[model samples]
Target chain A: MHAYANPARFLRIARWLMPALLAGGIVFAGGALAWGLFYAPAERLQGETVRIIYLHVPSAWLGMLGWGGIAAASFAEIVWRHPLAGVAARAIAVPGAVFTAICLATGSLWGRPAWGTWWVWDGRLTSMLVLLLLYAGYIALAAAAAASGANRRVAAVFGLVGAVNIPIIHYSVIWWNTLHQPPSLSLSGSSMAPGFMWPLLGSTLGFTLLFGAVVLMRMRMLLAGAQADSRLRRKALSAGEAA
Target chain B: MLKPKHQRMVLLAAALTALLAAVLIAAWALRHQASYFYVPSEIKAHPPEADRSVRLGGMVRRGSVHNEADGVTVDFIVSDGRADVPVRFAGIRPALFVEGSGVVAEGHMVQGRFEADNLLAKHDEKYVPREMAGMTAEQARQTVAQTK
Candidate 1:
C-alpha cells in the first residue's frame, strides 16, 4: 500500500486503472438509474419519489465516505508522515463536496411530496449541512497550506477534527428529532425489501468506483503540481547562488 | 523505513491523542442531548415519557386533521405506517401544512396528545404551479406576503 506513496508509481497504476473504473462505473450507475426509474416497483408508500433513492443514497454515502478517506489520509500523514497522504486528502475533498450537494438536492426533491417538506434543520439534515461546510473549510485550508509551504499542519489537524462530525451525522437520526427518515440500510440488515435493495447496492458500488477514479485523477494533478513547484524553487535557489 | 522527523512525529501523536479524547468525551456527553426524531412506529416500539419534551416527525394521517373553533388550535395524527401519534398545536398552520404530508411537532405528550409548541410543515421538491419556479427574490417575498 505504502509503495504507491511514490508519485511516479501511483501514476503508473492510476493511468491504466482509471479508464477501467470509469467504464465500469458508467455501466453500473447508468444501468441502475435506468432500472430504478423505469423498472423498479413504485414503493407502496412513497410512490414515484422512491426513484430518487437511487441517486440520494449513493451520494449521501459517498459524501461521508469521502470524509472517511480524508480522515484516514490525515492519520497516515500525522503518524507515518506518508508523503502522498496530503495529496490523497486534497484529491478527495472536492468530489466529496459535490456528492454531498447531490445528496442534499436529490433529498429535497424527494422530500417534497414524500416528506412534504423540502428542507429541515433537523439533526440529520443539519449535520449533513455541517459536513458540506467542513469540506469547504478543508479545501480552502489545504490550498492555503500548499501555497504557503508552512502551517500545512493546521490543514491536517482540521481534517481529523472534522471527522468528529461523521459519527454525529450517522447517529443524528437515532439521537435527535429530525424530518429525515431513519437509515434504511445498516450492518445488521436492510429495512428495504430485496427488490429495492439490489439497484441501490449496484448504484452505490458504481458511485464508489467513480469516486475512486476521481480521487486518483486529482491525486495525479496535485502530485504534478507539487513537483513543478519544487523544481521552480530549486531553480530559483541555484540562480541566486550564480548571481 | 518511512519515518517522520522525531519532533514533528511527537507533536502529531500528542495532538491526535488529545483530539481522540475530546471527540470521545463529546460524543458520550451528546448522547442525551441529541434526541432522535421518532416515527410513530418507533414511538410505539418504545414509548417516551408523556411529560418529557421530545420531537416526532412523520407523515400526517390523511383526513385526520381537525381545526378547533378558534382555528388556531388544531389536532392531527402523525403516522409511519406502523404507528400513529396524536398531536395538538395552537398556532397558525403553515401554508404547506396539509394532511398526508410530512410534519414535525415538538413538545410533550400531554393527556394522550402530543402538544406541540412548534409545528413545521415539510414540502416536497415539486412545484405545483410551475410558473412559480422562476420567481425572483422580490417576487418570492411578495408571494409570501400575499399568502400571509
Candidate 2:
C-alpha cells in the first residue's frame, strides 16, 4: 500500500485496473438487477413494488460505504499526508452525494407502500439525511479550498471531524424505537433467506468496485491538472530569469 | 480580476441552486403518486379509483383471516365497526398485525378486491412489561395506550 502511495506508481496500476473494474461492475450490476427485478419472486405482501428494495437497499449501503471511504482517505491525508488522499477524498464527494440522494428517493418510494407515508423524521431517516448533508458540505468545502489554495490539511481535519456521524447513522435504528427496520444483514446474523442474500451481496460488491473505479479515475484527472500547473509555473519562472 | 474567495462562493451558490432545483422537480413529480391513509369505513363509502393506489387502515376483524396454501398470502378483513373491507396480501405479515388490531394495507382496488401489496400492523396502545405473543390488536392498543 505504501509503495502505491506515489501518484506515478498508482496511476500506472490504475490504468490497467480501470477497464477490468468497469467491466466487472457492469456485469455484476446488470445480473443482480435482472435477478432482482425479474427472476426473484414478488414479495407476498409487497408484490411488484417490493422490487424497489433492490435499488433502494444497495444505494443506501453505498451511501454509507462512500462516507467510510471518505473518512479513510481523510485520515490518510491528515496523518500520513499521502499526496493522493486529498484527491481521492474530493473525487468521492459527488458520487457519495448522488448515492445518498438515490437512497432517500428510493426509500421514499418503498415507504409509500410499506409505511403509508413518503417521508418520515424517524431516527434512521434523520441520521441518513444528515449523512447526505455531510457529503454536500465536504464537496462545498473542497471547492472553496481549491480557489484559495487552502491547506489540504484543513480539509482533512474537517473530514475527520465530520466522520463522527457515520457510527451514529449506522446505529440509529438500534438505539431508537423507530419505524425503520433494523439491519437485515450483519456479521452476527441475517434475517434474509439465502436466495435473497446472494443477490444483495452481489449488488453490494459491484457497487463498491464501481465506487473505487470512479474515485481512481477522478484522482488521475487531479494528478494531471497538478502536473500541468507545475509545468506552467516553472516556465514562467525561467522566463523571468531570462528577462 | 475576480477574487478567488468570491469565485468560490459563486460556485458554491450555483451548485446549491442546481441541487435545489433537481430536488424540487423530483418532489413535484412524485406528489400525485404519494399514498394517503384511509380507514375501512372511508374505503367502503368512497372507494378509490380502480388504478389509484391508497392505504387502508383499521382493526383486523376477528375470525376474518384465512391463510392460503402457500403460507405467504392471506385473505383478511379490515374493519372500523361500521364497515369491513376484504383485503388480500402476500408476504410475511408484520409482527404486530393480528386479529382485532390496527393495520395499514397498500395496493389498488381491482375487480372489487383491495389487493394489498403490503401490510403493516400497528402495535398495541398499552405499556406491557413484557412483549406479548401473537398478533392481538386489542392487546396492542391497550399496551400502547398504557405506555403513553
- Best-fitting candidate, scored by TM-score: 1
- Candidate 1 falls in which docking quality class? incorrect
User: Candidate 1, residues A101-172: lDDT per residue as tens digits?
Assistant: 999999888766665557866778889999999999999999999887877778888998898889878877
lDDT of 2 by residue, B1-87 (tens): 767655654654465456556655654464333323566777788888998988776788999999999989899988879988899
Native-to-model Cα distance after best TM-score fit, residue B136 in candidate 1, in Å:
48
Report interface Cα RMSD per prediction.
10.2, 12.7
Q: List the per-model TM-score of the A chain.
A: 0.95, 0.95
| Runs off by more than 4 Å, candidate 2 | B1-148
Best by DockQ: 1
Evaluated against the true structure, the overall lDDT of model 1 is 0.80
- Candidate 1 deviant stretches above 4 angstroms: A234-243, B1-33, B36-103, B106-148
